[model samples]
Target: MTASRPDIRTFLCRSDNIGVLLRDPATGACAAIDVPEAGPVLAALDETGWTLTDILVTHRHADHIDGIVEVKRRTGAKVTAPAKAGSAIPAVDVAVSEGDMVRVGSLTAVVWETPGHCADHVTYWFEGPRLIFAGDTLFTLGCGRVMEAEPAVLWRSLARFEGLPDETEVYSGHDYVLSNARFARAAEPDNARLVARMEEAERAKAEGRFLVPTTLGEERATNPFVRAAEPSLARSVDLAPGTEPERVFTALRAWKNKF
Candidate 1:
């Protein structure tokens, strides 16, 4: 039998942060992925009438965990946070490490210790639904800034997702497509796919719709950060075609920081 699909809701919270709710329709079990603000999360739950059952945290960042206390208090939902950040986050009912399984009724998500954006960052990969909740680690057309580790470390963390199928839908924590598109265009000016994606980003922004939950295939074809191993990306950064991908990634990230 085919795996049951989830009902997903995406909304904007606290400026650029993206809030997502994943619901298992069969059981009416709903999980909020990283609460940026309790108000938006509560409002979303109210609008959908889906009772909050779980709050899956991705990292220890303030924006990601600020709403956890209030939301958990309001709904009495169990909180699942990164084991590495257990001490830092508030109201965590379960602390998970890499390879751990978290269940929201019939839906199961495997925890991946995707640190680089921060030491405690973890990605929740719901394999059955082909959905990856990569908070602060990967974004639409961009990756998060390397904060607690080197750029190569961030690249290695991103490489972990390469083994997953291209059809997998990536749900990142932020709405940064516009800025990411600008830097992506500069990183690979000659990439036709990148140009097309830029136009799409523009259209989405004009329509007042968030351009998120981008497919892994779309990210692979256009994201310069994810495409750092490509010879064309190396050449665009003034590096030799055969340069190491990690070195190429480092160069691109540096250029983006200053861009």
Candidate 2:
């Protein structure tokens, strides 16, 4: 599986939002994760010459699903969205929940309900490919804004990914690596890994490159929100030296809101 990785193309849309196209080379089947808008998605599909077979909606956010109807109208793709979010998203033909399997060509993506950014948020994990389309729940060095769940609940929701293989490629819904790196520095200014990543992110953005597809290992080591349990990060944020991980996470979220 590692030798023949799925071909993925990530493009920018709707300001800082991201649109991703994942194609299984074996089957020439492509899946689009979150249609920020129809124009860019259609353009990418046209440029790649890969027919869109599935549209995986991680949540009901307008930026994530605004192009669903148009894309589906054009490609006649099957729409798989979070269960119970059908009303919020248009043209959802199949509603899935945790543990559901979504088959696209030769790949099967397992759904994980990760409600934090919103109650309807979910993530698609392609086990064989080791790729996770983490919509709004997780980002590079940052997590989604908690709008529907308590901070602790969101923290727990994110914790579920702690068991994933380090090599798993994580594709998020936004190009927030630069801003997130800055906030992470505020949390752990002396972290060498974070500092190096910050420099890399700066260069990537300066040259107009995409700053995504970071691995789980990178996130685990340097993501302040994910490493909230570390005493060093707790102290950096002025939390009690031995504060619980969830408590530290809550404080970090509040601080980021103002950052």
Candidate 3:
């Protein structure tokens, strides 16, 4: 890849919201993660002088994929969505699942079935860029609302993200830094890493910087849900001092829901 090559850039479309734009310099084929609002996607396409080649949808939520129709109509871009979500996304060119792979110019995305937020939600992960379009499955500091599944299912779905390299950049549907930080504190009051991350996120957002694409390493260190086994987190959740991992994990998530 050349230095002049276009890249994947995440833009803030609203307070605690994001729209990921993927720029394929080789073909000038731009693709968006979720189309919360068309304006930001159009703005990114305009700025890059590229045409949209595809719209990658994770689920059926309006916030996650309402712009599919307009975007495809305007650009004739293909829409790729989970096999079950195809109905909501008109003219789906590709229906994917856990083992499928999707292509965009020279880029390839592997699909992961992350179904707690919605049973059909599927995250798309690109190789070279090492980016994961997590949608509402995972957030910087919190997981998506467990609307269609149990906490156990969500925990498992989120855990699927654990093996990606520590440097994997997570691009989520929303910028939930502040609320997530508060939850992190309640989950792990004594976590020095969480403390620092909360303050850092506050200052960064205060300065108008986007607070997403948090690395797996950063999340492991600062995210409370992922670190539910930590002693501080167990204590914060009111679990017995030496509670088993399973019990603590359950308690921690319950605590966060209240936070």
Candidate 4:
């Protein structure tokens, strides 16, 4: 029998952070990927009328876990966080590592240790639903900053997702698409797809639409950070065609830092 797909709700909190709610409709089991703040998360629960079952945290950043304590207190949700950094997060009940499975009602997510933005960062993937809660490791047109690791280390963390199905839906931690699209266009000015995507992103933001949950295929096509190894992308960024993907990736990230 096919597994049931989880319903997802995307909203903004702390200004630019993207908050996600995953619900198993069959059981009304709901989870919050990260609690940016309590008010929005609590309000979302109230709106959906689904009892919170779990809280999955990606890292130790203040914005990501600020609401965990309050949310847990209010709903008695179990908290799962990266094993390596479990001590830093408040009220963590389960410590998980790469390849571990987390169950939300009948839905299961495999954890991937993707540390680059921070040493404890991890992403959650629900294979049956083709959904990835990318956290801060990967974004629509960019990747997270290399805060606790070298550039190449971060690139390798990102490369882990390359094997996923092209149609996989990716939900990132931030709504940085508009700025990322600008840098992407500059890095590959002649790429028509990036140009068009930038235009579309502008309109979306202008209309107050949130652009989370982009497909992996779309990222592969338009995200310079994801396409670093492509010969055309390397050439656009003034790198040798045969340059190592890691090198290309590092250069692209450095450029984005300044862009």
Sort by TM-score, best first: what order?
1, 4, 2, 3
RMSD each, Å? 0.7, 1.2, 2.1, 1.0
- What lDDT tens digits, residue by residue, belong to model 3 across residues 1-259? 4333448777877555698888777777778887877777788888877788988888888776666777778888888889977687666888998989987787788999998888888998876778888988888988787788777787788888888899888888888888899988876777788898888998998898867889889989988777766777677767767766556666666666776
Per-residue alpha-carbon lDDT of model 1 for 1-259, expressed as tens digits? 8867899999999999999999998899999999999999999999999999999999999999899999999999999999999689999989999999999999999999998899999999998989999998899999999999999889999999999999999999999999999999988889898899999999999999877989999999999999998998999889999999999999999998889
| Clash count of each predicted structure | 0, 0, 1, 0
lDDT of each residue in 130-230, candidate 2, tens digit only: 99999988998899999988998789888988999999999999999898999999899889999999999999998998668889999988999999989
Q: Could you tell which candidate, 3 or 4, scores higher by TM-score?
A: 4
Colliding residue pairs in candidate 2 = none
Residue-wise C-alpha lDDT for candidate 4, range 48-132, written one tens digit per residue: 8889999999999998999999999999999999998957899999999999999888888999999899999999999989999
The per-residue C-alpha lDDT of model 4 at residue 182 equals 86
lDDT winner, 1 or 3: 1
TM-score on alpha carbons, each prediction: 0.99, 0.97, 0.92, 0.98
Residue clash pairs of candidate 4:
none
Ranking by lDDT: 1, 4, 2, 3
